[model samples]
Target chain A: MSERLLTVSSSPHARGKQTTKSIMTDVIIALLPATAVGFYVFGLKAVILVVTGIATCVLTELCCEKIMHRDVTIGDMSAALTGLLLALNVPVNCPWWVLMIGCVFAIVMVKQIFGGLGCNFANPALAARVLLVASWPSHMTGKAFIPVDAVVSATPLAIIKEGGDAIPSALQMFLGFDGVYGCIGEISAAALILGFIYLLYKKVISWRIPVTYVATVAVLSFCFGLSAYEVLIQVLAGGLMLGAIFMATDYVTSPATAKAQFIYAFGCGLMTVLIRQKGGYPEGVSFSILFMNFVTPLLDKYLRITKYGEVKK
Target chain B: MEIKKGTFKKGIHPSYNKHYTSSLPIEIMPSPKEVAIPMSMHTGAPATPVVEVGQYVHLGELIGQAAGYISANIHASVSGTVKAIEPRLMGNGSKVSCVVIENDFQDAPCENVEKYDPETVSPEDIVKIIQNAGIVGEGGATFPTSVKLSPGPDAKIDYVIINGAECEPYLTSDHALMREQAAKVAGGLHLAMKVFGLDKGYIGIEDNKPDAIEAFKALNDDSIIVYELETKYPQGSEKHLISAIAGREVPSGGLPAQAGCIVINAGTAAAIYDAVTEGKPLYERVVTVTGSGIKQPKVLLFRIGTNVNEIIEYCGGLTDDIAKVILGGPMMGPAVYDPNVPAGKGTSGILCLNRADAHIEDPSNCIRCAKCTEVCPMGLMPMYLGAFSQKRNFEKCDEYNALDCIECGCCAFTCPARRPLVAEIRVAKRGVQALRKKRG
Candidate 1:
């Protein structure tokens, strides 16, 4: 009789079949194509760097939870995703110690110290990358730009910024050919597109931010240059695809309102273009995403949706 | 004419599991040994007991009289001797004043009960008869029908919306009523429309209930059109139904009359028909006793004062895995802790769920998925409202229009984080209302 005891709560005894863990797992599945291509293109060095980043973040989060007397939430896979995204953002040739430091900074200072997961004001991965780029600029540039079985390759942004005779076809940039160099995850446009389609199909992320962000970049790029080839190069080059699809669409750090998401995306695109054209950095995806991460709360507050049946005289 | 299907935007499709009892015709249950009829069945003042203990009352005899203009009378469901008049626990988890009776097993009809010709009755007379017979909104609201009938002289009602959209999963009381008694239901619809001087009626049934829709279509009443509605949870809701069928919006914090319409539940219409024509009180209502945990899922014509335990025992008792016993449909029903609780006037279902259907998680953090906001029928952001409520910030919660929430549980059901959005928002709403009352 006790075993048949009825459980009582408020109304809505039934619930939909989704959880935060399932959502996080869906995100991991969406990132598979790009991560797989990254490991393939960058060889053992890429695998080692990614593993180091993931392991460091996981261990750092565990230690922080223990030290701060908080419940261990590594089971949610958010920390692991943070580790993986941070790993993808770094150069394939980044030293293991530098990757580990970035991961620890992300999980401990930028995330756990501010309160874990959704409580963090900015994306932990992007914050860690920005911090690394600021203090340890040497580790972020040089040597990381060399692909497997090729001589040192100048990134499209570097070649365009500095006078260089190395110009690759648009198809070469899309396919991420043998010698063209960038971050581990940002190399292949094809892989990122596959990942983007998967995310959209799974309903894990909407197309508003990624689609609008890319479209804004495409429109703003032509204002700086007139030719179609130059515009295509601008769109296809250096971290735009990866950043637009993945980082700009981070659920916690981005705006939750549909209208606010468009504003946030447009802001990200404008920041990326402005940074690339005028700022000191050759790649501007991380800085652009990080910049708009702070504006998400403001957008969510001010940009109101007209509620159903509500009217103004 | 292209039939415009009635539907509100952005509602989640929970599996409509009406198969268990949709086809099962309602079987009248034998009178239970003891009945405890709660006096406070309607929303207004509780009915005052008229019969003393030890008095023998025949079936359909009035035992409790309406205490105010906004209340309904209570009738005996069985020929019995009144054993006691005391407070008893009702299925809604509240102890209300009730008259406990000992059934004599002889189904003696009351002398005053007789059928009247609907064609000879005036609209006001029909409304008076319905009020005397204790007909309330049987759509789980139990608001006295008399109040809704008089929506004020200025409101020019255009249509009578008959709600047959039993959108809640696993309940088919109204669906069965529509299938078996369509003519009587339509008669009640006409009676309700006559009260408002309205000529047209719309019988809004979800497309999922094809048999119910077909039953209404066979009525051949040109004035009362059978409108098929899109199958969505809370489509049976008055605001959503009015919006879908009548193409008008009931303003926020307003009634259906604000949209020039009156919405009545299909069950309420059937009850009104019985009250007006057959001279019968709302003593027995068809209740769908269903879920995977029951040995037999069925729709039984339940006597109002019967206990949940008696119903469960009559339905072949509970299975070994039964976990939660709800008093109504799963979405908006109150969970019953004790089976001894009496089924109320508004009870539409008695759900005994097994562990598989009763599984729920300890709520976690919100991931800002915005699925709650997207699927919200009210268009209020439940995420911010829930967060503010959790932090006890009543001002912030009110600023986000927490008052607009219909408490439909849509946001809570759709949230990937499984946050208790509805519960927290309910708290916030109460707090804000209290604060406003204090300030005034």
Candidate 2:
């Protein structure tokens, strides 16, 4: 017989069915519930914002990869996931140019510049949100709109910032109805929670970060001399659910050990609670996650896991 | 001690494709026209070939003598003429001295081989019987069994453990061995108990094979206790098996006897019984040939030095779509680059895998998901270990217990990014060793 061809590879011949593309697709599927909810709450404007965010990010990623002579890995869906996340973190009526700039920065600058996906030192969406908030404060804060019909009256956190008197009822805050003013994805705690369950079921993400982060925020906010309803409001209000479930748990900027993950999530909750209670910001989710992102490398380095059957030195 | 549920923590449930060959009884393959027997089957110094070219050798005659204390003797599996003693490719992809023999088709036995009764033999004599049989661990780890049977003066060997976990996917040789030859397996365990002068022996079988478990349970009595382990990959790993059944840790750079345990394969135990009772050398073994790429999947009792090509053809030849063929269990088996390789002592399975099963994805960057850590049976942070390895950060890799990685491929298998976890960590281990050697 003529020499037959064969493939030589390392041991562990089989791989699990999940791929990077499949995992990113799972993340996209998990976000669909919140995306649908955002459309219902904010109408067609939210759809335009999402499509623009997705298109700009995907375009920016393709251009950057081509310019850098790198393999075009936009098909991995990571850029799409980043785009969806960036759109969810901004207002439904965010200006088209502002949204495009955020997408460009998140994809080309924050992610691609750092060698893409896992190499980024911070969450691309959160960093871009930070950049946008810093750049056009009035446009982001709704002060530029200044019309009762132009925007929802006040965010629950905005009401709580002025001593909690106008804070909506617990059920209303949880349902995120009656013109609840927040980012497109962050409005409905109920829909975001459904996404969280979907993520858990698909094994896309673990329960550690979301559970620990939310519990830390809820427990600490209760200790700030607020009644049970106000603490429930704090837990359900403004980006707390969305940030804890999605942003704080971004795999790229997170710790690589289970115990360190708990510590990282705890740090996020503590920072968010501290910043909300004492700092100038009314919502602390974005900055809290961003701050924790910078702390990820240190967490991974210092928190070396003691291996199984490893004896004490 | 009563086990409420026998399990070692944090392991993956890989698809145990044992069904392909588990029900089949062992059939001895017809002797090939030519057999290439490698001199080095067991670990340690490669055996020194005592027989020269053109010498007449009988079946079960010593052709290669043990070169060192840690090595085992090699015997001819077929009655044949020594056509050549030259270097040939072994299953491990190494060029070694192989005794190329032309089979005479006469199953002639050597007259000098002797058998001893277990009742009449002393503990010291029992070790000699195993050594004379040229038996080594058949669990794909070809450590000389005589060395393991005797753990030296420093170790107090209290427990005799038999490993029947066979947790690898697409291999069922050990399970079939245990099922059909339960009496031989039990008798072998008892002989090992005699060698160790031990009162208790435990056979740890993964609970997936109810028939094997039932067969072993039927032979269990006062001295022997069979425990059904939780079905998990790498559950059959020697250290993991000892830990799961004996509740002891063979520390890094340590032996099982250091933890008061002597672990043997259930197949090895049966081989020991045959050696002690009938003076049979380690010649033939059970091998499972199964995968989607094979036309037939079956277990065969094949003689050593049999060409892997003959075994494949006997299994109904390879399907046209076959891409890779592994020489052992899929999880830890070495991929053979050439079909000319012969079956050595450690080959327990021949997997003819399809393209989909054999293809490696273009690995993406590690997402730091830490699922590697979650499913690590060795409790290693493979995420960081792989990163450190790729960075050539050998020191950090060591600090993260890179050497402790059992190379089970769990991290890589579960990685959504498809990072080469085991392959990278293997680099770190080699680098660490090179560094240590340079320093020394």
Candidate 3:
């Protein structure tokens, strides 16, 4: 017994089974339904875009870590999750090179340059989508949506922005617009809800952010004098479910406490409604989430919960 | 009287690996041939050695005298001749002066040992007897129980709570004690309530231990109320247990007396009863020798100063792949490299973990997931405390109330990034203390 080597450390020799790799794996598993829906709606091009996005993001992460002399962390599956979220954020017909550019920008500029993984101040996928929309408007926006019949058309949000009655019905928006088009993941609200349920069930994310975000949108939209049908369409339409469930709830970019999370998500919902109603952009999810990501550190610093047994004055 | 069930908020439920020894009967191990009793087993000043080398001492004989008002007396666990008085390794990895003795196996009792009738003794005399017996909180804090019993005159302590929660994973000494010696535990509680001049006493047991609960409930003592607490890690924590049973929060930086409560461990209660009724000193305790690395898991009542190596050898020795040997429960127990370290007053369990269970992963950067904040029983944000401590920004750590942290390891255990949140916060707490000292 005296000859045997033993490890000595401080208290807590045991650890919980969850790891960064496992959490990333859970998020990846949760996104499968939306990815499958995207593939079914937009055919092989969606698959190609997703594959390209993942490969480029993963390769870029490897190169960046090597160049920075940091440990290779691609095994954590974070870069792959970002790649998948990026693919879902863009149109299915997005040029392969354009999707690749978005993927590299996400992994390199938004994630690795500021340090890595937890150090990134912005959601990589959302920031890259914003950059792409600004740089290549034609490739990213107008006539970018292609329905199954190969007809190029405006998305439901775009139709709503144009004050056109051709907007799809609420039910069509809830399922997917059969005759209309949107971003690959935003095409089906049902698929996004399925993914959200899986995430909640797996304890990957909490309900405070997503539930508060969507409810804020619905409540504020009605307060803005929109009809109940229009409010339902607004709740189920373009990127709202996807962004609220996936993007805004990103752990690295969101607030840390439940109170701060409610306030941050409320800010996102309020900004999204304001931008969609009055700002220059027709869609608001990406911009609102990215803007609120910058405020997360402040919210966390100020909105700390009262410590147990604190003596209140 | 109806039994009440209660719980505090925001504690994690780690897998309680109590099945190995929870059902096993407490077996008394034969006293070892030699023992090395440390003078610093209890918190506060170390006891002063009163015996020299070669002095013959009987069992229950006072070998070391309490040096200060806060220290505890040390007694000989076995009748033996003193071999040496030197520094020896202890379970906490520190070397303290020890009274090494070679047991003669004479089983002779000390002439000074005397018993008293509980009905005839005053509460203050009982407290004095407890102090003379060197009894401390046996749930591992080892704080001198006499200090708790004699609170400041201004303190208005109204509750006497016995902690039977035993919330730590893989340790069942308390459970076995409660199941096997329920009457002594109840008698101890009655004695404690008499000291406080209180009518009601409470025992807080986690709902997971229905057998221990049944044992206590079977007593049918009207003065003692058994509360079934939610089975959560750290439910045995003094502050949390007070919050759950007494419905009071110990003020930050204050003792349980500030909350009108006096919380003692179940083992400590039993020891108190023995000290008063049979004139026994606290020279031995029940320690659970368990975990995946041990060949056999058991609850053993052994001499206090016996080396962990002998205890493990009695438990059929370690398995072939044993990697870490913790001196207590996994959560708060210190991992010791030397198996020769003697069990002290606070050693509750000897947990031998295998290679797979002892593997520590390389921690990644914090993702700001806030899972640590969510599960922190103290309600302090551990993520920022860890970050600021890493950055060496003690001012930020102080501003964040890092001093309020209980070092429960809840944050570290639940972190997905495997960040050593508790370890970092401990550093921050020290830093904050130094900063306050400098300001003063």
Candidate 4:
């Protein structure tokens, strides 16, 4: 025993089975339902856009790390997740070149430029979606793309914004049935809910952010004089489910403590509702989440958890 | 006999690999050829050597005297001739003065050994007896039991809780003790209650050890309420256990006495019973020698001052790929570089790990998954503390209350990036303490 050289480090000689790579893999698994739904609705064009987006994001991450003389970390699957999320945020009929550009902006400008992964101040996918919406309005809007020979139509939120009553039925909006025009992943509330359930089951994400975000949106919509039916439509329409479940809950850009997370989620919901009701754009998930992402550090700093056994002042 | 299950919030459920020795009856190991008793096993000033070189010291004879108000006396574990009193390596990688003795193989008892009448023993007498017996906490903290028993008069102590919650992974010494000697453990709690002038007491045990719980329940001691706690890592932590059983939180930076509680380990309680009833000194304790790296896993009543290497050999030696040997449970145990370090009064488990089990993956960027904060029992944001500490920003660490961290390793254990969160926080804690000291 004396002759043997032992590895002596700090306490906790054991570690958990979950690693960064494993967690990313779980996230990727959770996104499969939404991706499949996107393919079903938009056909081969969606697949090509997704493949190009993933390839561009992964390659951008690898190239950035190499240029920065850092360890190549694409194996952690973070870049792949970023790419998938970015792809899902785009219109299904978006050109492969436009999707590639969005993936590069997500990985390089929003993510890697800020030291990558957890250091990113804004969620890469949301940031890229905002950039795409700003740069190529014709390609990024809900009315811009015709999905697989379907007639072009305004998204449910756009119809609501225009004070129109002839919107898609609740079931059509929930299931993203044929001719319901929207971004690839945000079209189907059912598919996003399925992915959210998988994430919850795997402990990949907690219920605090998504539950509070969507609940706030629903409650605020009712307070703003929308009828009960309209409130239900508002909750299920557009990217509310997609953004609340996947984007607003981005671990790196969200507050860590439960109390702080609630406040941040509420802020996101408030901003999202305000923008949808009064702003120029018909959608606000990307902007709302990006705004809350910038405010995350402040929330975490000010709303520190009441430490265990902390005496009341 | 219906026990209520208790738990603290925000703790993690690690894979408790206790099956290796949980069911094994404790077998007494043969005394080694020589014993090297470190003078500073307890958490205080080191004992001063009283026995000289070449002196023949009987078993349980006083070899080192408590030098301060918060130290424990040291006794010879075997009847032997003193070989040397010099600095030697300890399991935690510190060099402390040790009294080395060559065993004579003759079971000679010290002449001062005498039983006391528990029925007539005064509370002060009980404290003195515990001090003389050199009984410290056997729960790895090694705080002097006498000091804990003698909390200042101002403290409004109400409950005397016995910690039977062996929640650390790969450690079952307390479990074996509660199973085989439940009465002694109960008797020890009774004595502690008597000292505190309390009639009722509590014993908190993790629900994973149902047999141990049944052992105490079979005693039908209504005064001793045995709680079945959720089997979670660090459930046996003193503050958390106090919270779980007594429903009181020891205020931050305050002792358990502040919460009207005094928690003692089950092994410490049993030792108290033995010291009062049979006039036995705390020279031996049950140690769980088990891990994937060992050929045979067993619970053994090992003599203090025995070489850990010899104990490993007694357990059929190490497996071919044994890479690390830790002196306590894997969660908070320090891995030893020198396997020959003598087991001390606080040594509870000897966990040996194979190469695969011992390998630590290289850390990547912290994904800020908040898993650490979620699992932190202290409700601290360990990710921030770790990052601030790594960047040498001690003030931010202080502001975040890094000192409140119990160093239970929950953050590091559950970290997705394999970041050494606790290790960095430990450095920050030291830095904060030094800065405060300098300011003072």
Per-residue lDDT of candidate 3, residues B11-116 (tens digit) = 8888889998999999999999999999999999999999999999999899989999999999999998999999998877688999999999996899967898
TM-score of 4: 0.98
- Which 10 consecutive positions of candidate 4 chain B have the poorest summed lDDT? B1-10
True contacts kept of 2: 0.63
The prediction achieving the highest DockQ against the true structure is 3
Q: Considering summed lDDT, which 10 consecutive residues are worst modelled in model 3 chain A?
A: A144-153
Residue A30 lDDT (model 3): 83
* lDDT score at residue B207, model 4, on the 0-100 scale: 94
Expressed between 0 and 1, the share of native interface contacts present in candidate 3 is 0.83
- Which regions of candidate 1 are displaced past 4 Å? A1-3
Give every collision pair in model 4: none
lDDT of 2 by residue, B1-440 (tens): 22223778777877777778888999889988999999988888888898988998989899998888999999999997999999999877789899999999998999967888877877888898888778999998789999898888777888898899899998899999999998899888888898878878888988888898888667646577888898998899888888888788878767788889998998899999999889998998999999987899989999899999889999999888888889987788888877678897888999988887678788987877788888898888888888888899888887888878889888888888888788898999998888778878
Candidate 2 clash pair list = none
Interface RMSD of 1: 1.6
lDDT of 3 at B307: 88
Residue-level lDDT tens digits of model 3 in A95-182: 9999899999998889999999999989999999999999988888867776446543688788888865487877778888476478
Per-chain TM-score of chain A in candidate 2 equals: 0.95
- List the candidate numbers ranked by TM-score, top first: 3, 4, 2, 1
What TM-score does candidate 3 reach?
A: 0.99
TM values, all candidates: 0.97, 0.97, 0.99, 0.98
Best by lDDT: 3
